[model samples]
Target chain A: MNLSWMAWTQPTAIFFIVIFCLLITMSIWEKISPGGGPRVGILRFETTRGDRLFLSLLGSAFIHLAWLLFAGSNLWWAMGVSILYAGFVFSFV
Target chain B: MNNKPFDNKAWFFVLPVFILVAISAVIPLMTVVNYSVQDSFGNNQFFWAGTEWFTEVLNSDRFRDSLVRNLTFSAIILCIEIPLGIAVALAMPRKGIWVSVCLVLMALPLLIPWNVVGTIWLIFGRADIGLLGFTLAKMGIVFNYGQSWLQAWIIIILMDVWHWTSLVVLLCYSGLVAIPEAYYQAARIDGASRWKVFRYIQLPKMQRVLLIAILLRFMDSFMIYTEPFVLTGGGPGNTTTFLSIDLVKTAIGQFDLGPAAAMSLIYFLIVLLLSWVFYTVMTNYGMDAPEKREVES
Candidate 1:
């Protein structure tokens, strides 16, 4: 019934502003350097399965969110174990 | 490759995510901002508090302790999970039905929700009834997560490792699978030792994914709450009181709005900053990736 808003203050305001500034700077850096990959850019990679990367990220996020909804705290522990198992794949699979 | 006409229509499908994220992320965020500067009493009575709570929270020892604890926990998790995941990846089958089975099995733990994971461990760690605690006692070991801070710490860390290692494993597996068999074949033809091959070939191939794994784990671990909260409730003392847990206590338990909002903002910024470092490091490493060739059949 009663809910208090607790997230607006000078520190809070300053913190978010700084985060946005940093994010903008990151975008600029990403454009300028582009990380020395194929130099092909997004349009060129449209031919490849680049869209799948977006699909995977979104899909994984949803999967985790679903897990959170269903299992609550148990989901985190399960996912924690899963991450370890996934790490094994990283090392030797 | 099918040179199908580029479809701008897919962007329409993505609109829901944009909307959803805006609602979930932005709305609560704005609400938090609103609370940070205002004072409220019962029945929606409110007044301007300005930055009073912010100054108090910033100067509070409790916040500092929780922040330190969270940082330490995240760092420890990164150290353990990243290497463990990589090791597991290195040991798995390259191509087989078994690979699929293993992947799914590993991913099963990840599919469970955070709170449920905590509940499972809570049940599993009881000295009187829990399998783990009972077994350890039977084997002449004393373990009590409910009372001892160290035990609580160990259980939480172990729970996290068990739950999240699979994510690292999956990421690393994908990275490993993407590697051309030619690299291994060439190493074999050159009589390279397994260790040498791993160090020189496999490690380099996996650097990008490993970096992503580390960053993801760090961010998640830093923000971890639900599981640990359900498990120990920030512990017998403040031993396990992570920053997020502390913020919740101050905000909800103590009803200290301004300070909680300030802490949340700080927490968010710290995560964002670390994530930026991770991205930068990964991108720089991406430059070193060689033009790989597939092995001929």
Candidate 2:
């Protein structure tokens, strides 16, 4: 939490911490099961779990930005939408 | 299908690289994200404004115009550079001492710093003093890039083609040389035409490197700032004020941190999405070709 060196806000720091946690959780999941083979999805590419995580994160960023542009500053709706998108990416892509 | 034993111990080896990337990239990127959602007054006073800048920047005429310019520039450069690079690569000598000399010469332009390349063209295109414009002035035709938008565009595009076509040529040349002699000998024995030889053997071999060349060129052109900035300061008028130059004017000149930060994030996302699309399309295109050939046979 002592992030003055980089001048990070609490929320922004928490956002990155969540991403870091996701990575750790993913590694642990991979270790427990170990068969995250690349699967061709509707996106038409072979993507493993890691790649799907990446896709979800990237998609979420765009979704958040788009939401801000069109729907204004109430971003809780955007976060909900992003969570669903990540679910969709994980399940299918 | 990596079936090696799943060991938790392996993560430690990758930790140093992860930490380095975190320090270099993620930390700075977080700072930008922090600024994007906040309003900052002088002397480090900040208040959370929550995406007001993002909406403003996205809706602005200036941002939209600069984006269109950036896209057009990337498209024009990619269209010109890729084929030219491939053609120059094909024309290169494949044997003897000439190959090294040719490579060194090809690399000379790339060796020049980008700003220096811009400065060189700035002087080189001046009508009264420089060779290109002076020679044109000596004839009936007179031109000044500073005065005309079209002339500025022409000079910037010409300068880019001269500077970066070498990169494509180098990548394609490396791809060409990797093709075995046997393929050429077989093609020759088949009495294949020059075009057929190129279309079938040489091109398929160059596909990987060409993908790399195209991706690099597209990304570089989109993010281009130094050369055109130095030459015409993003060319001339509304047409040549690409996103980067516009971003700098907002961030540094106006010192509008919120809008600039928002623009930077938007710009970063656009590049990331396009690069992803390009990678997907090129890889799938290459993958489909061999499978289609197999099915036809």
Give me the candidate number with maximum TM-score: 2
Please give, for residues B208-290, the per-residue lDDT of candidate 1 as tens digits: 77777887898899889999999999997999999889988988998876668767765666665576456546555543443
Tell me the spans in candidate 2 whose CA falls farther than 4 Å from its real position.
Answer: A1-10, A35-37, B1-16, B275-297
Candidate 2 clash pair list: none
True contacts kept of 1: 0.31
Give each model a TM-score.
Answer: 0.69, 0.88
Candidate 2's docking class is medium
lDDT of 1 by residue, A1-93 (tens): 334434345554675686578557655654555432232333332111222232333333334334544555344564565556444432332
lDDT tens digits, residues B1-297, model 2? 367765679889999999999889987889888888788875676777776888899899999999988899999999999999999999999999999999999999999999999999999998878899899888967688877898888899999999999999999998888777888899999999999999999998888778878888988999999998898876557667899999998899899988899999999999888877776776767556445544533
At residue A21, candidate 1 shows an lDDT of 82
TM-score of chain B of 1: 0.86
Every candidate's lDDT: 0.73, 0.87
